[model samples]
Target: MGGPNLEVFKFGFYIMFPIGIMYYFGTNLDSKFSVDGFWPSKEQSNKIPTEPEDIRAELERLRRRRLERRATRLAEETRSQQDMAGDGA
Candidate 1:
């Protein structure tokens, strides 16, 4: 079951089949299937720090923000507990 024509056809099929499939499935995939507004817009996205000093500054800012949030949450919890205690008394 070996012939020159058949071997050439087999080689062509092997090469072309995957390329055809890739072209069909890969074209316009992001636009067609992607959900609109799922990704953050350029203005909303945070820029990554490129310099060492910038990175350190960003880390410090984030740390301070986190601590502030934690402090505020703890204060709210404490106030809620105090209110509950006063209501029971």
Candidate 2:
């Protein structure tokens, strides 16, 4: 059976041990774990627009590009199907 002193020591050990370990190991963790080019550089980040209007315009441009690609793919599929039908006749 543990005494009050033992219980207090156990509590302090449980609390202090992990904090000490983190403090020792966490200091250089970012530099150690980070990969080169994984994060945007300052110039690349600066090119990204922070304004709501610019963000919306960028999104709209991407959406239009995606729709254009989809339309071109669908048209190609339709033309291929028509050519197959013409060949079968």
Q: Which of the numbered candidates is closest to the native, going by highest TM-score? A: 1
Off by over 4 Å in 1: 1-38
Steric clash count of candidate 1: 0
lDDT of candidate 1 over 18-82, digit per residue (tens): 99999988999987789989999999998999999999999999999999999999999999999
Provide backbone clash counts, one per model: 0, 0
| Residue pairs of candidate 1 with colliding backbone atoms | none
Q: Which stretches of candidate 2 lie above 4 Å from their native place?
A: 42-71, 83-89
TM-score, predicted candidate 2 vs. hidden true structure: 0.50
Which candidate's lDDT is highest?
A: 1
Write model 2 residue lDDT over 1-89, tens digit each, in one string: 99999999999999999999998888898876788798898877757779999999999999999999999999999999999999999
Error of 2 at 26 (Å): 3.2
